[model samples]
Every structure is written in structure tokens, then in C-alpha cells.
Target: MFDYQIKDNCLSNKNILITGAGDGIGRQAALTYAKLGATVILLGKTVKKLEAVYDEIMALGAPEPAIIPLDLKGATKQNYVDMAATIAEQVGQLDGALLNASMLGELNPFTQIHEQIWQDVMQVNVTSQFLLAQALIPTMLNAKNASLVFTSSGVGNKGRAFWGAYSISKFATEGMMQVIADEYDSSTLRCNAINPGATETKMRASAYPAEDKSKLASPEDIMPLYVYLMSDDSIGETGKTLKAQ
Candidate 1:
């Protein structure tokens, strides 16, 4: 069921990093990139799940993927810097970075948004991305070209009564992408965000437990847009938000 006509080996010789890659869309994207011939770096909190993706990619004879266990909620700026340094030592230069890690927080009314919960959500869903991107851009700039894709939500563009922190975090995500994109407009680096509408993932299940999952598209269904954004094919295209249907 996982397939994209973007072709095999389109990312050959490139190195891409994806956060929250242990499961959900991040996991599928990592696998897709591996199959497309990119040396995929899987970053997440779960080592076991990362190993599962690593094995799956290796089984396909794709590049032996790398894994970094990181908890976005608690990770410090130094942690991100250290992570980038390690990637630089081993990978030389980065071809792409996908900031797919995010926390849904709680779906509640605006006035019911607790300060602690809001802070936690912003830390994982926004601050961490800022720090991670700040750390990794050097590796990307070192390459001939690079792409940075942040994951967004429908509620991010429009406020929802019960969406709370998750929605606010995504708005920041969009702003972050725009700022970064403008910073490197004259350079080889590009930044953008993707709103993968309703997808079959744990986050989706959590958000819509009453909804039928079989009715929604799988994360794998959006691989085309993912691959396109990461590949050189999308060169010169940056800063715009894309909706993956």
C-alpha cells in the first residue's frame, strides 16, 4: 500500500534527518526516503521502534539508517547542538531535515488551557523545532542544497474551540517556516511546512477516537509530496505551505 511514483534512488547520495521517526508519518517518511536511496537518520524517543524502522530499511537494501534517541519535550538546546555535531562528524553534509516531531497536548476550550500544558506543548511542538533547525542548518548549508519540512495541522491555520495548544503550536510552526525561508532565500537552503490533512496515525486516532480510522488515508499515501519536497526536484521552491491529500 506504500507507494509513490517519484522513482527509486532519486535521493541517492543524500542524507536526510527525520524527527519523531519511531512511528506515525515520520516513520513512513523515513522508510520512503530509505527506499528512495537516501541515508535516513531516524530520531525519536523510542529506540526499539527506531530499530524496527532501521531493520525495515536495511531489509530493502537501502542505506543503513542511523538512529538518535531524543525526547523532544525535555531535550535542551545543547542536546540539539550535540546531535548536529554528531551528524556532521558522520554524514559530512545534510540534504534534508524533517521536523515532524510534535505533541498534541490536550483538546480543550481556550479558557481551559492550562499554562503548564501550554508550555509543554509549545516546547515540543515549537521551541524544539527552532532549536533543532538552528543546530542543523550548518550541515544543510554545507551541502549544495537542502530542504527543511515542518509538519503542520489543519487547526494551525484556523483556530478550533477545543484544539487548544496543538493549534497554537502549529501557527508558530508556520511563522517559523516563513522566517527561516526568508533568511535563506538567496542561499541553497529552503524551509517549508506541510499540512497532511487527516491521516491514519496515532495522533489522528488520539484526536478523533470516535472516527473510523479505516476511512482516512494512511501516512504512506502522502509519500509523493514528502519525496518531492526533499528531492532536488523541488529546488527553488521554498516557504510555501503544502497540503498533502
Candidate 2:
């Protein structure tokens, strides 16, 4: 399905929310969705970066995007509920959501990790995603069909030494996707996780500082799967973990 050709307006009239929309794959997904005719909600911690994406979308003559600055680490369940209410009031209903915001607390031995670091990683990666999905599921169900995509890593599906809390959090992510997918298997709401292996981004640079950057694919290069999942092409596909290389 990733290799399939997508129509120009495959996502027309859709309202999609993308967390971490300021940079990397999240940014590229927001831009691509907007260009394909979806009204994207750019959610990230940096207002300036979100504004830049909003400007670029307008400049490209795509649908004007909305900006929502949110820091997942400090966001509470009530905050997520409020955000969901706001989306319902303004956007009517959400056709899709890309839970792309995450943090790499540190890559160290599990036995040597600190409590605060583990908590921070879990809050941003696992807890925040849970709360966000819990709030958005109702709105998503309102649409004729909806897609929920979670960002995963190679280490997420398998244990890797020194990955520590980040790896553990990703495992939780995969589990969450599976549970949700199973619950909605008989419904029009589909959920899946995408593993973007070795993408060229700041996170990758931090994780592998000595590696050659040219060998890695850019975030924009792995967007075919992103577009495929968000559009109607992957309607019956759920609970699957896909890789983008």
C-alpha cells in the first residue's frame, strides 16, 4: 500500500492533527496532508515553528492550517480533554491524528538510569499519547472513517542494549496501538504504528553522532507510508506495525 499512487485530493475535506508538527517527520506529514487537501492542526511546543509551518502551508496554496502549541511533558489529562473539546467545537470532527511527539531522554544502561529521566520519558512518550488518544477517539468515531498513526522505532519492536527508557516507552506504544486496533477492529476507526528506521533528523544525529548522515533517508523521503495510512487506501488495515526505510 505504501507504493500505491495516491490521488491529488485523497485527503480532501479531512481534518487531521499532527503532534510535533514543527520538525522532522511530523512536520513533513503536516505539510503533505495539507497539500493533499486536509486541514491540518499543527500541535507542538514551539509556537514560532508551528507558525513557520502554517506560513509555508499558506504559501503553497494548501489549506490554511491551525496551530496548537502544547508541551506533552507538562500536559495533564484535563488539558487533553480541553484540547479535544476545542477540536470538536472548531473542527467539527477529526478524520485522523498522527501521534508523532516524543522524546529521547537518554541512551544509557538501564541500571544506571535516574528516576526523573525515566519519568520524563514515560510522560512524553507513553502517558501523553494515551491521554491524547483517549480524548480524540470520540471525535474520531464521529467521522465516517478515521486513521490513527503512532510513530515507532526499530528498538520498539525488539530490545536493544543502552536504549533504556526510550525503548521501553516504544514497546508500550506498540502495545497501546494493538489494544486500540483490536477494540476498533469491527469499526471504521483504524490504528497502526509506523517504524521509521534510521531517518535523517536531529534525534538520529543525537543517537548516532559518528554515523554518516548521507546514508540515512530524510523525513520527507519516508512520507509515502504516512500519506497512504492517512488517506482512505488503508481502511481495512489495523494493528499492523510497518517500517519506512
Candidate 3:
């Protein structure tokens, strides 16, 4: 679908929420969507980073963006519910979401993974996403067309050594996306997952410290797929895993 160019203003009047919007792929997606004409709700743990993004958006003369400073690792179900309620009351219906926040727990043998680290990874990458989606479904339903994009990993599809809880969490993410897609098959809301293979981001550097970063695609480079998946151009595309490289 990304082979064709997305026209300017494709996202005009759209309201999208992006988790991890403070940096990396999430940050780029927020900027890209705003440039294309969407009101982006930035959700992330760091206020300073989110503020930077907000300032950048403002400087770009894009649509005014909103900030929701949240830590997925500690966010409760009620917190997600309240977030949805807040969006409904303050921002109206949500048109899309990029569920991009994730944790890279210590990569080790499954048996060697620390219990707390495993739990933290699952909480941030899987449980919080599920809860967020559950809470936001109503807001999405209000839109004529809604899109939900989950960030997946290559290790999630095919198990790799030493990926530990991160891999397992991504697998769960893929399953959650599929479940939501199936459940919403009759509705206008669509759900899909994207695997951003070997990107040049902090996470990638942490995972592969010795590798050359110059060869990897920057966060901005893979945004066409992100833009397409969130736009109306991807209508009827759901329950599929896309690679952004």
C-alpha cells in the first residue's frame, strides 16, 4: 500500500494517539502525522521529551498536539480507562493509535531471566497495550474509520536466542492485535502490527552495540509504512504484520 504516495491532508481532521511518542519511531510518527494534518496525542513517560515533541510540532505550525505523560509499566486498567474518558471529554473521538511503547528487558536465556524483569517487560509491552485498547475501543468506534497499530519484532514471529521476555512480549502483542482485529471485523476499527526491522534507534543500539548504526534505517526513514497504516488509504487492511525497513 505504501508504493503509492499518500497525498497531503490525508489525515486532515483526524485525531490520533501515539504511545512512546517522546522518541524514536513514535516521535517520527507523531511529526509525520502532524505534518499530514492530524491532531496527535503524545503519550510517553518523560515529560521533558514529550514537551520537546510538542514544541517541535508547534514550531512546525502543525495542528496543536496534546500530551499524556504516562509510564506503561505502571499504568493501571483504571488509568487507561480514565485516559480514554479524558480523551472523549477533551479531544472527542480518536481516529488512530500507534501502540509503540515497549521495554527491552535484559536479554538472557529464558531460565536466566530475572522474574521482575520478565514481569516488567510483559506489563509494559503486553498488558498495558491490551488495557489501553480495551479502554479506547469506544472512542475509536465513534470515528468513521479507526486504525490501531502495534509495534512488533522479528523475534516475536520466529524465536531467537537471548531475546528473553522482549520476544515473548512482542509475540503477545501480535496475538493481541490479531484478536482485536478479529473482534472488530464487523466494525470500522482496524488493527495491525508492524515490525520495524533493525532500525537505528536507542533500542537497536542497546541490543546490538557493536553493529554499525549508519547502515540502519533512521526512525524517519521507515515512516511511510507508518503513515499508510494510519491513513484511510489502508482501509480494510487488518490482522496483517507489515515490515518497515
Q: Report how far residue 193 has shifted in candidate 2, in Å.
A: 0.3
TM-score, one value per model: 0.97, 0.98, 0.98
Best by lDDT: 2
lDDT tens readout by residue for model 1, 208-228: 999988899898898898998
Q: Is candidate 2 or candidate 3 better by lDDT?
A: 2
Clashes of 3: 0
Model 2 lDDT tens row, 1-245:
24667689899999999999999989999999998999999999999999999999999999889998999999999999999999999988899999998899898998988899999999999999999999999999999999999989999989999999999999999999999999999998999999988888889989999999998898888888998989998999999999876
95-114: candidate 3 lDDT, tens digit per residue: 99999988998989889999
Worst 10 residues of 2 by lDDT: 1-10
**Model 3, C-alpha of 78: deviation from truth (Å):** 1.1
- lDDT of candidate 3 at residue 125, scale 0 to 100: 92
Q: Give the TM-score of candidate 1.
A: 0.97
Off by over 4 Å in 3: 1-4
Whole-model Cα lDDT of every candidate shown, in order: 0.92, 0.93, 0.93
Report the Cα lDDT for residue 146, model 3.
98
